[model samples]
Target chain A: MYESNRKSSIVNIYLGSMKIAYVLPMTWACGGISAPLSQVNALSTRGHDITVFAPKDGRIDWFPLAAPVQVHCEHPVEEYFDAVVYVGDTFAQHPFSSAGQKFLLLQGKDHLWTAPAKRNELLQGYSDPQYHILVVSGWLADFVHGKCGNPRISIIGNGIDINRFFPAPAPREKFRLLLEGNFPDRNKNVIAAIEIAGRVRQHFPVEVWAMARRFTSAGELVDRVFLDPPSDEIPGIYQQCDALIKTSILEGFGLPHLEAMACGCIPITYASGGVMDFCKHGENSLIAGVGNLPSLLGHVLHFLSDSDLRSQLKDGALATAKLYPWNRVADALERAFAGGIEGKS
Target chain B: MRILAFTRESYPSNYPTSYILMHQSMALEELGHEVHYYQQDKHPLGLTDYLNSFSFDLIFLDLEFLRSNPLLRILSQYRRIEPIHIVGALYSLPAPPGPAWEVVDFTITPWKGETTSGLAAQFDLRYLPLAYSDRLHKRQSASAGSIFVGNTTGNKHKEAGVYLDELIGERSVFCIGPEFTEKYMDPFMLGSLYASSRCLPNFHYSWEKSGDCILNERFWQTARCGIPVNDYSPLMDEVFETGLLEHFCFADTRIWQNRIRNLNSGAETVHPALIQKLDDSLKEHSYKDRMKQLLDWLR
Candidate 1:
């Protein structure tokens, strides 16, 4: 699996136990919220004193977090961390100015959609010399470097919890196709995913299952919809699905496809930048040009029809998942905090 | 004195600026001043020919109007020949106060910040901050959950996030934004929404909060609705009488929720001191006061 490839190649840099404060923009259940929390949990397991500082609503029931969460609530954030890591561009300038080694985690191209003044404020952070830019995908690293002209970037791609998301083989009556993410976001392009599923259903006895945070008009097309299911139950859903289809136009590092791969589900996705890190077209994943519905539908049809191809790709998917264990992600994050991050991937 | 005011006509539903301008015009009219409103679309015309239609003592407009319509340069030249005093309400400017501001005789801002301070240093600027409309904003029986109104169609999805999402799902919170509707609500309907809500959980737009501790016109209007306003800003101290809104205001959402709960239950009602302060500030900061200030400056 990709985990073995990731584990064998990744240089484990131990910078000893360091005090880290993971600054959460909100205590929500999206990839931006989960990625940092997952890293915090993994690092805490490695005996680091990591505390999650959220601006408001500190109770995170979605992800199982090992680190303690401190809701600063209007009060100034504590300034005693060895490294203060901020994710995305939601908060004000210098949120933890006094806190030690500052790192800004670039999750996606979210700033493009914000108000012009606010967008400028977000982009300003990327160019600031005080912040060490850390991104999930290599594409994002290039984005910051090309856009902001900043060379200090580290690519610490998101990790999957193998323990939580592993293959659970079970007899299925019908081939199930899965879709996940917040459908309402225009960037996610859930309508395209639904369209692909509807087209797939016409050819085969396919039951389209969707795990979404919000139900939109496109959601009506999905056969079975799960709204914000707990993290623990996600693997079971992935295991039952034969293929996971994602038609997202943009992704910082598409985590769902990797998680599905870990659960032995073949990923049928678009060339959504971040997914290109692991999703090798016609090998591990069936990746079409972004927004190309015909090619996506063709790949799904071919994968379902050819059992030999399915077996080979499933193995490829498993190998891809083996590369991104949470512990390794935490190891890279520790190096990033210690100012030992290798240059952008 | 005859006053000609230019304001934006096409404001989306519940836009605070629309209500602010409405109240300003109403106050001017109430003060026995002859005020003629020339409402225009977002892309306004200077309408130099239209200006010739009226012989006015003073012309009132937003500072943004000067930046948008270059034809206003004709109006600036007309200002030299005519005995008309041009006043611009400076909420924000795209660029620094430049030659465009030369057309404006006086500048007024409803904010106290470095921006206003810098402008004050360079120009004839007055710190005439936001005030509630007593004629419109009045208390009514409220039973619904806490509410906030802003441009949710934009990046507010990122800003409001879980706090707004959970409230929208769990409570009777009317988190109305542009995403809900594009129709502009009349002042009465807007006031009703404020007064009917249990509380106003005020989250400032990033620009509003950036360096400048400026309170929105919504804050002043909502305060008059007799609902607890859980807001953030050091400007609260500057705007309100000492310790008047401190207990009612919160910088944290947890404490904000507590304040809302306290108001919802019989445990807490609108504090007598805050009500008195709002009443006193209502008259003190009203558009009447603003108009009187403008007249006083013109004299």
Candidate 2:
């Protein structure tokens, strides 16, 4: 009697007209909110009903969030959604109904995982059969699996808005290094970044672009610094820069690296966290051991002195960025929605 | 008191925290207490052997050592008689005790606030503020400009160093720590340098991260050498009540500037009463007194 299913494609990977709900924060500056918001738009175009539950009623101009992806505080539980994606640590607290595949989208580790009541309890949430983890990087997936009680996890490269970010002409008398992050956060490793920048500046005469959150002075080490810039200005800033230098020991997905990569800027970062997925060692980006000033200096100096290597890496980085459009992310989500339902049933 | 002191750092002390521990051990001995020190770098197994073998009147556990052992960890299993166990460390610590807190009799920390001590009541927490040893109390023949000793690799630290430079004006400020030189100095060597500087200066990066705000080992080192400190820190309010404004604690940066200007003009300001206060503080806040208080509680 099931022979009638012969009309279906080779594999029924596509979830036809599935209803999905994403619970996220309305934060303007948060990378966690922006990454998912970009994907939700792609999913909406693919004919999936997307509802985003957020407490805020209004919207900011820069975020590129529009139609089909509904943002409301009220739960659409009465509609019986097929899949539920809880965004980061804050939204992961929302309750899941007896039905639907629950996925916890973790954008970073360390700070988010340890800040809560206990670490073991968070791991147990991932281990639960009712829930599956959706992280953007292999490093994060491995990190979560090792910590959690269960090995239920998946890695989908966080898609980029390829249209908004691209290479632009700018002054490059000395190689421009971009460092963007909240200065107060310990996880950002702000002090270590400044030290790494200083080591490079003394030898190479490099200019540092520090978009430091709540900062007064760039100090003698950093060449240029700004307190706040509009979110849209980030892509242009990345385009004009030669490289993105970071020192964070723990990261879920280093978003700035991805944004900079789209604009043809090479990244020199710690071989830690999700960003390692795109910023492959010696191929598209330079890698260094976390908190090792000497090793970081070696990479920065190599990038500054070598022009042919920078051009080669810049081409490699741009090619890597092109591979991750929001549509590709939506395709992965469709597979997860279909497979998860089959497993649960 | 028959005390056993433990450390995770080198025994001779190459860093600030270890210097505090080494000085604390020497002070206990100076108070006529028989003390034996075992450091992890050299004597890891010897410490374990002693733990399983000896019967002591009191045990002083470093925060690092208490968390080192896993299988043969707890003191109750090795000892025939109960020793007054105290766990303390010079590192920046939070209020709630760690895994070993329930097993210990008391916790010795530098953080002095109602909230921290209140939360640590179950472990009978003792507030032993950071103090310089009696060995560093000698006055120098000729003292000059300030000396800054702390990390400088950090942006905040570098910024603070620059701020100190502005306050000191044309006068010399010798900064002999990270970014200056890598060579490690013991307490005696560090003390000799402390005595030469007219004022020992430090600045706060974040009060939340710092233990007890301003009650650092720098304050004790300055007082012992009869030097003035230039900074606004509320933690000194506990010890210097009456002379909070005049006696070494400068609330205003401008006032600190004027004081340094006056010092450069050649007028010695170390009053006899202030000298007496430093001596009294050295005796009152010694690790010897801290141990005695815990022992009394244990009895």
The prediction achieving the highest DockQ against the true structure is 2
- Model 2: per-residue Cα lDDT over B1-299, one tens digit each: 55666555433334456556666765654565545444446431334444432234666665545554552265645443454555554255544335566556666777666556555665656667777666545567546666666532232455555455665356545555545543344344566677777666645555433444536676676666656565666666666655633656676666665665555445646666776775565556655566456556667
Off by over 4 Å in 1: A1-13, A90-94, A218-220, A340-345, B1-299
- The candidates score, on chain A by TM-score, as follows 0.91, 0.88
Which pairs of residues clash in candidate 1, taking residues 3 or more apart in a chain or in different chains? A1-A318, A1-A319, A2-A319, A2-A320, A2-A322, A2-A323, A3-A322, A3-A323, A4-A322
lDDT of 2 at B106: 65
Task: Mark the 10 consecutive residues where model 2 chain A has the least summed lDDT.
Answer: A1-10
Computed on C-alphas against the true complex, the DockQ of each candidate is 0.01, 0.02
lDDT of 2 by residue, A70-99 (tens): 455344345567788877653345554543
Q: In CAPRI terms, where does candidate 1 land?
A: incorrect
| lDDT by candidate, in order shown | 0.71, 0.63
Write one digit per residue (lDDT tens) for candidate 1, span A233-298: 888999999999997766788999999999989999866667778888767988764544544666
- The TM-score obtained by model 1 is 0.51
Q: Runs in model 2 with CA error above 4 Å?
A: A1-11, A57-60, A68-76, A90-93, A96-99, A110-121, A212-217, A226-228, B1-299
